[model samples]
Target: MEKTTNLQETVHSPKDEGGTTLGLSLDKAWAPKTEEKAETEAGNDSTGDAPEENHDYVTGYKLALLLASVTTFFFLQMLDMSIISTAIPQITSDFHSLPDIGWYSGAYQLTSATLQPLTGRFYTRVRAKWVFLFFFFIFEVGSLICAVSKSSVMFIIGRAVAGLGGSGLQNGGLTVIAGAVPLESRPFYMAFMMAFGQLGLIVGPLIGGVFTQYVTWRWCFYINLPLGGVAGLFLALLHAPDQIKKPQVSFSLLRKVIPQLDLLGFAIFAPCAVMFLLALQFGSSDYPWNSSTVIGLFVGAGVAFPIFLYWEHRQGAEAMIPLSMVRQRYVWVSSIQFASLTTSVFVGGQFFPIYFQSVKGVGPTLSGVYMLPGILSGLLFVLISGSLATKVGYLLPWALFAGAGTAVSAGLISTWGPDTSTAKWVGYQILYGVRGCGLQAGVITLQNVLPPAQGALGIAFLIFCQNISTAVFSVVGNTIFTQSLVKQITALAPSVSPAAALAAGGSAEAVRALAPPGSPELAGVIQAFANSFDTVCYLLIAAASLSFVASWGFGWIDVRKKPEPGKGDV
Candidate 1:
């Protein structure tokens, strides 16, 4: 409950401006005072206790400007994650490296998921406003690197760097809100922030397509420069109280802080995650399932995961994923549900463009346009879920709805063939959007149910799970799509080499160029691509089903009312 910063020593007295001070400490700041002091403070008009409670409740012009920055960064970060999907084809063609497509997407999420929890720790143990700005700058730098990269390896490196920075923006947005706004109004603010992000998520592919088809795929990364600059400016102008204690820069302090970061846990986890995903991506394509390379990766991941868990358990409070937090029902369930549902979203987003371009014979720009049905519907449902959660005080219905609805929609999507009508595709997307809407409601529910002290940790853990799932599932989808396309095409077109079809880049244009337009092999190529897409959709269904089972564990906690003082908010 100690003050995060020495406000009395570092800042001017609050008496000069309406007699208030920043309520900027963690859970301790909200702790109840002794009975005598509480009674005395209540009676003393000069102590300014009432005004202190309202000090950090940002409002009017300042609130608007702050939200503008948060929304911009949210959009940019989400956009960065998805924009690469449409650009991948052109990127692969340019580099002449089709086999490395999984790295292009998975690399970003790899660093993002692994670094997210550590960033949460940084926000808690440092001057968070500065940390937020630092992360944004890093993101901007990464975009610039991506825009100018000359090779696939360079671009993949840029993506990993960008993810390291992006890990902070979305999570930092929530942290800023928790610090500046009271608990009662958080859901509305969270909804507004997420709506902006959803807009980015939906528009990302379209932007990437336009850039790739009309100009160059590099523009997708170039667009981030000016937008990020504007967001950075707004954030710089805002003066906010520190949310946590700032560590003084010194070798001694650095030594202490390093251990608190649980570097050992991260060391174990990074390898574990990489090996697990590498094994899945390599199996059946680059290597046989039982090949030494694939088996070695699996064995490494299996060993690393347990070691990571053991290290984290031993680290106690400093653990990347603290054992205490994971044990809580609301925390673990929310993490699992968010991870599973979002994996479906990531898998669909990754492959939907291929479906449109390869099966439907659409150009990149038009393929992005075709994806609008799913993205727009998903955005609409996100806002609706937030509104419903705010009004109903319960999130269980939305979770249940998301799980079952996504499963059904995924099954429907899997049934789509080369001859399927546009209406059916559009309808299937709308059905899947139901799951998208429920995502943020689960976040709101998590924030509401956990104590304020635990909020940062919970949010970080959820982000980590979501990102890691996205990374793993993107690779899983990519491997499945590539392997299926090769197998199916080889079956129907014995004259077409599997390598040639794959190298043509998973689209109709590539297939058409490889086979004569009237040849039976052209039809088979398209069918193979469609079948590959269907595999991703089937995986989506399984992920959604697992999410449904996880949602049931959320129980019936209502978050509408504020918790009483001294209770741990749950």
Candidate 2:
């Protein structure tokens, strides 16, 4: 065990030169040193620690302010993603394009997911601040387009554009925090950022429901204009630590990296994602399991995935994903946990409103109101868990608790009958709120474990997993809903076919038209939905259990130890 004193001297001397000094100091001098441990565990390989020069400097308060702004931007971006779900029914009716309604959500998700890796590269090459501002403008433009959109195509286009900007904003929020904040202070700032994002999630549905019921769905898009303007303005005005040095764009670098980008990998990856999402959304309704489209999609994803893996390994250093990172026990396990947690959230998001509208007979606005408890719970937990993590320096127990709580809450909520009491329902929502707190805390823990230089890349990879998992699980949950509904409806009404029942657009109006007044068929529909919800909850529970395993895999890393005098933070 050894203690270092390099930081004290560097802190006192302020220099305008290109080099910036960072030092780490440990309070407990007897703890086993990082260098000694690394030597014993692996070898004497240098960890690429180099002194940073001409570093961009910003005040801590200013950095915090900038973090807040970016977090708000992220909140708005995600709000637009989920807020529209409740309003889709109304939007489709007004536009008279029910058939193409899925596009509204799909377009945003597909484009955003596809561009995520590219954005990670872009951040490395370009000034993040200007890049963020550009995206902000694009987001505003997309919102304006949606606000005035006269047709479904126009709205889809607008959503696509918004998705592009949102992809950047979401990634930028994490990247900026990683770049600007010291490792120790990051948890606190991350908590604040995540809280803002949860606030947006809570508000988005409620706002969307209100606008859809009272005003128009267009307002959902219109509202972003003013909010985004304010956020972007603040960010543009603020100064933060700049990590990107001047663009060192080199043809040689590109030549070395271009093959690693793996265009073939994307060709396979993109279609697999799109097809799989389509299978979930349209399966059993528009296409059967044996149908050519569904079969083709599943088979394509199956075949392409292995090829992508082989290419990734072969490309090695130049690969889009560093295989070493993927191979790390901590990294892969954390990523799996992250993916599972995201799946749980996505599944819940999809079905909770259905329960409110279809079973509880609540309007869209009230459904959003029902979601409030979960959102608030998540907000509170994110704050507390973050602070706790900072103080205690351990994240496993909290993550396990969150996973278990989420599973239990989902299971309980799945038991709701058509006549379930509102008080009981609210209790389940509270459990969901607790779940939110744990999820964000676990994410921060994963980020904290990585070296600071890889922080942004780690966050980006986690987000990539989240996006892919959400898309895939959302599709699976939808499939469960459709399959259960068809089976239940067919059993209750032998004369009516599944296709005929679904043809009415899965709306309450169509269900009423198909079932006679006070018939057993209506009860069957309710039962079918109950079964579907239960199945999804069970899946979430399984994921939560996996999260527990992943949480336990976290290894110890000391953040307080300072590097040698010449060794840089990076």
Candidate 3:
């Protein structure tokens, strides 16, 4: 009865100061007329509208629970993404599918990137609680499938499925956070969620290492089940604010909502994304850079991109990329900056462990441990930046800090040699961590600059950029590393077959066994690995430097100040 009352109130509420109630702005065709009728018959105001006020119904203890639920899944999804890096070797060894390794991470990222903006529409049109819950379950099912996979094909399929769900988790969390909190206090909460959420990135490799070494690699996927269940349970029990809106489900409503999903734009963009990523994944690795297959994929992506843009323009508000929103300076700039930053991070996530294993000759567990200095330092700055943003009311400083820090640290890492000291490597990582993590603060600035209606879509678009860039660059990083290593191995260790070194699947253990430990040939092989890593680090520096340049465009906005009635956009 109470649930029914809340729904009725939300259904009839006037647009609040933020534009609309978080979950309550469903189209008339999608809302339940019967509920409104019943509330009217019960002597409630037939208007059924919530009171006009700025009070946040989702505050106090409920908000805490909400944060916990959303952040938990956020952490788990990130952990799931990063953990697979360390376990890739075991997965390949078990399936004997070294050539297919790119697809494992690529599949997840592809689906996640493609589905992200669409999920934003889902949140806006439907109840965010159900949407979040649905995606969380999908993520769990994907994890289950991954855990039970017997072949590379099945595992990649599972990863793509998980990515589909994981796409919603972060965006959904941010969307919910946006709706539930007041504008002034949002930076702290956003920072808090992101800081702890990044702990997954830190612990991911560590946990993956332990599971891969002592237990089965499958445990990496299995671990999500219990944690996700807890998050799902909380979401199920907690309710959106009474003023929050939700879409009503029916066949007629489905017809309206389906088109609003802009499937045509997605159809165009999905192929574009797939083709481009496939080209990168295959070029100079699976196929010659000049191969017909590689050229065809690139050509297809290039052709499809303009068509996708045209389609999105036609769709207008229904579009995934929404040109209306994209035209805004802040939206596009933030998207590009976020894309570059995350691209570098994801590339680093994959290759850092490779450097530890192949170049430094450390095992998976130790490699994860070695990443802590950077991860911990990054987390500390994320927190500090968030707190400072909330207090100072500006966000550009954080972006500049992150961008400059990332560029410097990544540039330093490019100098790493086969025999670089532990102190140097650790120091470089700390430099990257301190500023790299400050990007979280930028989220507050971006979201704060837009009205609530636009903010959700903006956040989704930002996430889409991040994921798509990560997917594309991961392939680029792999291609560079593989090509460089093969070339260097041929030059440095002429007697060691380059193909054999490549086939060893980049396992330090397997590569070390090629010649006696401490022999000149073994040293050459290690040096080749280090030199290849240097190439990837240079790539990171370039991406990070671009991100720094992009940061300069975000005009300093005091996020804590409430925008005047008509001043949301820059």
What is the lDDT of every predicted structure here? 0.75, 0.63, 0.76
Estimate TM-scores for all models: 0.86, 0.80, 0.87
**lDDT score of residue 143 within candidate 1:** 91
Candidate 2 RMSD computed on C-alpha atoms after optimal superposition onto the true structure:
8.3
**Per-residue accuracy of model 2 over 1-570 as CA lDDT, tens digit each:** 343222112212222255542111222211234323322212112343321322455556787678778887888886876687667656755665444544566566656666665565445434567667777788788888888998878998897787677667766787677567655666777778877787877888799889877888788888888888898899988865534332333566456444435466566666666666666555634677788887887777677777767876665533445465566555676777777876787667766766666555566677789888877887898888877767776565677777777878877877787778888888887887666555654456445444333344456666777666665555566566656657766776665667654444323444455666677876666555556556667777776667666765544332322245555654
Residue range with the least summed lDDT across 10 consecutive positions in model 2: 21-30
Q: Of the pair 2 and 3, which is ahead by lDDT?
A: 3
State the lDDT of candidate 3 residue by residue for 1-570, as single tens digits: 112221222222223476743222222212255324322322212365532222355778998898888889889988997798788866766775555666788888888888887887776556567778888888899999999998888998999999898888888888777767766677888888888898899899999989988898899999999988888888788855412344454566556566667777788888898888888878846788899999999999999999998988776655676676676666778888888987777788788877888788777788889989988998898888888886776566778778888989998999998889989999999998966455675476556555444456678888998889888877778778877988999988878988777767655687797677888998998899899989999889888888889876666555664433454654
Candidate 1 stretches with Cα past 4 Å from truth are: 1-55, 241-256, 563-570
All candidates in order of TM-score, best leading = 3, 1, 2
Candidate 1 matches the true fold with a TM-score of 0.86
Instruction: Give, for candidate 3, the lowest lDDT window spanning 10 residues.
Output: 1-10
Give the poorly placed runs of model 3, Cα more than 4 Å off.
1-55, 96-99, 242-244, 247-255, 563-570
